[model samples]
Target chain A: MTAAPHPGRTRRTVVLAALLALLAVAMLAGVGLGAVPVGPADIVRAIGRALAGEARVPGDAVIVDIRLPRVVLAALVGACLASAGVLYQALFRNPLADPYILGMSAGAGLGAVIALTLTASATALRFGVVPAGAFLGAVLTIVFVVRLASLRGALDVTSLLLAGVAISYVLSAMTSFVMVFFRESMTSVVFWMMGGLTAASWPYVWMVTPMLLAGIAVPLLSTRELNLMLLGEDRAAELGVDVERFKRVILAAGAVLVAAAVAVSGLIGFVGLMTPHMVRLALGPDHRVLLPASALGGAVVMVLADLVARTVLAPVEIPVGIVTALVGGPFFVWLLVRRNGHR
Target chain B: MSVRLAYEAATVGYPGVEVVSSARLRVAAGEVVGLIGPNGAGKSTLLRAVTGSARISDGEVTLSGRSLAGLTPRERARRVGVVPQQVSATFSFTAREFVLMGRHPHLGRLQQLSAADTSLAEEVMARTDTLRLAEEPVDTLSGGDLQRLALAQALAQEPEVLLLDEATSHLDLNHRMQVLDLVRELADAGMAVLAVFHDLDLAARYSDRLAVVAGGALGEAAPPPAVLTAGMLSEVFRVRAVVGADPVTGAVSVTPVLREEAVPAAGLGSVLVIGGSGTAAALMRRLHLAGYAVSAGALNRGDVDQAVAAALGLEHVALPAFGEVDPRAEAAVARMAATADAVVVADVPFGRANLGNLRALAEVAPRVVFADGFRGERDFSGGEAARLAEGLAAAGALSVPGDIDSVLAALERFTAR
Candidate 1:
């Protein structure tokens, strides 16, 4: 069908393009601004030489092996979490919804600890056992939460959030118990729980990139149904939306996104919560613009946050989750205060 | 006109409980049907059954002779548009965007709204008088404006059948009229409409046929004049109301008979209220509610007192508009005044047509209670009515200041004697 020339479409297109440019700059900075700082031309030459199977430069190993994968992985995880945030917020019609609010992080953390305790060799962990366990745990936890929140085929959003919080507490306690029992793996578990991109690698990036793409694309295509959902379920249904089936599909997609992000980055917080809010504040709540804009905005925030995490203390790397919360928490509070002041 | 929407003996509710049973309704093209009932009488449930939100457990709801059970929600929505009582929006969409969403059922999953759809949204907004609000955020609108926006959205659907569930309840009087008038215009243009109204008078005024829902069953749908009656108001609505044609608009007007439980016992005595031109309406109502058998006389046919007297079902004498009180009306008043235990003369102006009523009150002088109290410039009978009032006062007729309470007190003292 031919598109009508809408007045809002032009502004939305400009905003999306601007966000894409910002995301590219953040990724470039993430790849070049570390301890072994590489310039833009040197970074490009390194990628080109690696693709052509030529000889390595002095910083080629640092660019290709470390910073490139780390930046790519951060972008994928950020997009996944932020897109999942948009989906959950629309599904619940609640402003406070986030990617990890449904106990997915706690469940994934528990699963990773169990896998860490079970595996005796580091090679097994390198071969994708821990990420697999984390992905499975996150998906199962979301399914359990969804089932618990449904009553007679209708999903109650309030009960869903309440059950998620309760399940998160229980799963975290179980993870702590396992950590205390397996003292040798306690440091690894604690570091993972704080959430970092330190395990970023080529295999990890390849595995999660497809899931993140799918997570963003499905919701982007279903923006009409997502918009209808903001009008409330009954009204949306009356207006021809299959609300129950749509909810199931959206919840499943959100589960995949959060599971994929948590599997690689271990429990990154606030990117999911703050990215959508920022994009929505700048643009509007129309999911057609919101989903893609938030995905890009999230990538920018994550890449920059990850950069600060590794370089701010020289050799000592703070968790990326700590940086996001420290930066995002105050920014979100300021946005809220400013919004309330306008009203 | 063909029936565009029909509920064929439908029993609708959720699982294991029936909210409305054995309901049969037909809304044909080019007509508006009003559904009215008390709270919890399942009026809204029946409307929901048409949209498949509430299930029709036993029978079927059909759209244009096709069973609604076989239709997809999109197909049903393409044919029917519903404006609910209220909608609480969670996000901030412009009013134009909200209206454009009503075109959703006609578009494909990934299709954008065409230019025609945008213009149609504008058209509907204009019809609902909400064009100025097109750029305003929907969450910032008042309740009435939101309700109108909801109507505009439903109209943007361009459905063959429209359903409104108390959609105008939040609107003020002018907006209510404007909305319903537009609904009437749409019905005239061949759109079938089924509206649920809490305002009985508005329903009686706008509906081509009114269907009553009471005691879990749907009553027969008929014209407003046939459906809105005293018996139906008492039986179905639990109200003692006087249902009559409005004196000016010729529409059905309902005046409730509010009798307090602490009112004195009936058959107290007979009271003949001799007045006209609306001077005796309040006194007549007070005496009637105070257990007196009240009658009025010689009122012009189109006068306010005549309408009030007819609505209260009082025994009275009537005259033609601007006509003198003839011999038959005068004789009827004389007979009523002779039998009445007390005669009440209201503070009506002394015009030539009603001068005979004052003469009749003079004949029943002992039981006369003159409530005129010479308050205003009431004399217009060439000083004859003034002389009659003085003679009546000299003949031991009680004089009360022109208010119902004092008249009732004088009547009570006369009854005690």
Candidate 2:
């Protein structure tokens, strides 16, 4: 154990480099593999003209207007989901904890259903109503759960999980009621709940990007504080950490990021839970490196999962959530089996 | 020379609960004070209060006339270093890294370590002899090693006052002596070191002053000789003992009295226990507890077994420091064994010291030696016992067995008249 170049740090840097390369390749592949297949040379020419302000190629408009925005949005949302996952893991100290583990997705889904009902009567729900409603729902659910768990002036992870479970059931029930009540918007509500990039657009990306960046940055800065906290709240206090204040700040920032990602992408499962844990196994528990590594890893996992969802069946796209859940469920099972076997 | 730390009618405990109420005591610098008491006497709590970890309910804890509340944790670290009893590491840091963390208070947030700070840490490690295990994980080290590591870490901070709770309970004889020597050395170097020790002999040996904490308050703190008295030990520890000193070093060693156990009378045998101080206490207790009529001579007072004989009201002939064994003491041992069936000698250290006493006892009775005598180990009193055993065995009057159990087993085989 000759201290392997701060193994965690080295692994993280290598993983980050590999992820950047993967993202570049995925961007190229995403542009070239559609029904009207565009060659890389032609796409390169189109991209150059777009950069040089001289685009008049025949199919250039479709490629730039249609395909590029969707792929770009896929990458952005993928990065957002992954970064949110890392933040949630640090806040919960549980490798299995993700943003939706707190029931935010169920809350957001219920909000989307309500927005669909409002849009039936008026079109005010068109531009930002869906994401805005989802964001509000997520924030409200987080506040409720946090308040419920902070009854004794100290927050406990178990109580928070229990509160999240309770709210998730409540919201899921309400979402089902809206689904049955408005069968006309059943297709749209169903797609939103299953999670997809079918509605991915430049405007949606702009709306969620700021919240996502802030969310990632805030958790990254608090990485040192998080390291102290892994020893438990009381011990952390003895070492000069103001635990209550730190907890409040982390929870609020983590909630904002989770809410924004949920608002835009609906409920993309596993991206948040799986990426952070995989990073931790390679990186050790120092949040300083763990947080940034998780963010990069999460982005890579989400982007790849989205690629498979869009291309595996080609013309007929699969719901991105189905692919993630299929992957994450078995990964989680293996983790549990290995952990129990060791014990 | 005098730095005072004390409690003035102070009550201390957790939030809204008082474990120790109205404790009063004054501990002066340059005086190594000990706090001893029964369990739940709030001794640990008092230590916490002094370190500003626990809140004082009523009065304040002051150091050199300044309230402890006025000092920041960094200021306290600079002046007072505390070694908590239940020390555990959450993360596996190397011994050196753990020690370096003690230097946190001295350095500012962005300040790089100066050469002086680095050298100070090295010096403390060398002084504590923990530098050899500097790169080993704190979790993997043995108890003695961990204790030394803890002391080194506390010393690295270079504090003026050191507070240790049960620091030496895990050490062996050599380590105990080593740690105590370091404590005294530090104290002599003008750092006030207050340590808690369970070993009565150790506390009496190194501490200039001892204070007992019992019933949630501090008892009288005074010099070891004055504090570790016979009456005080009997009252404090709930055991009877004759308190005396080692003739070689003048350090206090107690002889405890064991309660007598009723045994059926067997053949009469006069047994002489020839063993060093405390080792004989267990044998004497076992012998007396079995209800065998027993007597011993040249046995030191304050030895645990001497106290056992006194408590059992046995016929014990003891040697006094003030005078030699008179005609009556020797004559009494002979008279008591005149009609006895057998004689057993324990593994007593034959000192150039106790040679005459051994010679006197060998003159009478069929001597049964404790088996350890023939092992030919280094003799405490030269080779007198080894030579005497040969002569007595040649005469067919002495028998040697392996251990305490074997000697007692052989004694039971001889039928009483």
Candidate 3:
């Protein structure tokens, strides 16, 4: 059968285009507004030369080497987290669900702290060891929580959330124990826990791109199922959805997205939780539209947050996570108050 | 007249506990069958079995001779559509979007809804009269509106068999009838419909057949007139009710007997009431409420007093309607009055038909209390009834006003003795 024109198709397209434009502007500002500022023309030339594989200019290293990878990495991590947020919110059928709600951040933090304490050399810590450890820990924690929550092959959302909370507390306490004993690694562990994109590189951007694409693509393909899931699992099942298998697929996808983002960016907060919620408030909750809009909205928020993180403190950089929370916290509250007032 | 849906000895429940056992039923291609029961009698479980939500451990539920256990959820949904009791949506979806989700089972994994599907959704929405709320968010709609939208969504599935699990409980009376009318129209178009209803009257009105679930077993499915009876109402529902045909709709009507308190076992002894043509209905109810074993005599069959007596589960002597009190009925009334602690003669106007009731009261005059209010004009036997009443007064029969409270007070004095 031929595909019908959706009623919200035009509005979704317009919202997506506007978000894409906003993301382009945010990336431009991120690249041009650092301590050693570059002009728009210079930024364009730097990107062009980098794409053409030409010889480097005097200002090319600053734009191409430093700001470009960081901005791109910020955008990827933001999209990954936001898409995860959308999947999770639909999976649990709760608007409050987010990327880190299943204890992924705490698990990653614990793993990163363990790696920092074990490795005597800071160079090894900076290489792939810490991120690999974080990824492994996050996935393991999610699997354990899922196993704990499932009974007779049915995954109970309430039990899953409770297990996540319990496991998060235990892992966080272990991380604190490691930090207290290994005094030399304390500052590094603290910095990682606060989260930053200071370790951004071309390799890191290359690593996250495919996974981020998969994260976004999976939710986009399953938008119909996700919309059905919002009514509830039982209702979704009655509508011919294989609810248990669907939950597993979504939970696995969300776990991978969050774990990948956490491995690269440490424990960034609020981007996942706030971005999807903002998009849903502006655009309605048709996952066909909400998923794509949230991906773009999330990328815009993170790129801007990273821009503030590097520039607001000048030479001494604040963690990007702190910037997001400081900005996202107030904006989220304002949205809630405005929505309540309308109601 | 093929059976589209059938439950052949189905026993449904979750893992060890059986909620419903040995349920056998069938619905033809163009019939509406209603399932009724008290709370937790497994009415919903039977519906769930059809949707494959509950497992049938014993026999099987079949759709058009094929077992439902083997069909995939999409296949089952394509054939059987269910409108559940309620749905709590966590997200804000427009009414149109919500209705479009019903086309999910028909669409393939990657297939978008075609133009045909969209028009079908619109058609169902119009049929359910919810097209005006298409753009409104479902969460913002009232309960009745949401229920109609749910029906629209279910209809959009285009299933051959429709199951409603108390779907109309949230609707107002007008909307309830509107929805049921739409359902009837659908059944007339040859869809098999099964609905669970807590409202007995509605079930009786709309159902061509009804299946009763009680005490974990399924009763026989029969026509509404056969299923809804005073005996069944008292036995299964534990309430006294009068089951009759509605004068307006020609459907079986059930009027529940509302008891203020449980009638004690003749705490004030038995009271025999003599009256006809509704004069003794209130007095019978008041006496029954006061913990007396109340009996009425020589009440014409189909009289208001006879219905009240039957509804109250009181022993009474009934005669043919509009006929003179026969000798057999008068003897029965005399036997009841002889055993009663006191007899009450209600302010019934004397006529040729019920002059026998006054004569029956005269045999036990010493134990009788008359609520006659000294009205000699009510004697239509031309002073023959007035002369008998004066003779009863002379024999020490107590006289009280026609009001119920004064008659009750006079009976209280007799009980004090």
lDDT by residue for model 3 (B1-417), tens: 999999999999878889999889999999999999889999999998887678799999999888997888888888888889987765678898899999999998788777898899889999898988887889889888988888888898899999999999999988999999999999999999999999999999999999899999999989999999888888888877777788899999888764324655657778899888889988988898887878998888777788778889789877777878777777888889889999999888888777777777767888889895547888998887888788888888988888988988889866764
- Selected candidate, larger DockQ, 1 vs 2: 1
DockQ, prediction 2: 0.13
**Each model's Cα RMSD:** 4.2, 7.3, 3.7
* Per-residue C-alpha lDDT of model 3 across residues A77-135, encoded as one tens digit per residue: 99988988898888877665665657777787787677666775766454466666676
Ranking the candidates on TM-score from highest down gives: 3, 1, 2
User: Which lDDT tens digits does candidate 1 get at residues A105-166?
Assistant: 77877776677678846754643777667767877788888788885477776688788878
Candidate 2 residue-wise lDDT, A167-192, digit = tens: 88899888888889989888877887
Candidate 2 has an lDDT of 0.68
Correct interface contacts retained, every candidate: 0.60, 0.02, 0.66
Off by over 4 Å in 1: A1-4, A102-104, A107-166, A181-184, A331-343, B15-17, B247-249, B257-277, B286-343, B348-367, B374-391, B405-417
**Candidate 1's residue-wise lDDT over B1-417, tens digit each?**
999999899999887779999889899999999999989899999988887778799988999999998888889888999999888775889998898889888999778877889989989999999999988889889999988998988898889999999999999999999999999999999999999988888898889999999999999999999999877876787765667787776778777664334335667889898878878878888788888988897788877777677766789988888888877778888899998998888888986777888777767888888895753378897888888887888888888877788788888876764
lDDT of 3 at A61: 91
Q: Rate the local accuracy (lDDT) of all candidates.
A: 0.84, 0.68, 0.84
Model 1, residue pairs in steric clash: none
- For each candidate, report its DockQ versus the true two-chain complex: 0.39, 0.13, 0.51
Ranking by DockQ: 3, 1, 2
* Runs of candidate 2 exceeding 4 Å displacement: A1-190, A231-235, A341-343, B1-12, B15-17, B22-280, B288-319, B322-417
Candidate 2's displacement at residue B341, Å, is 15
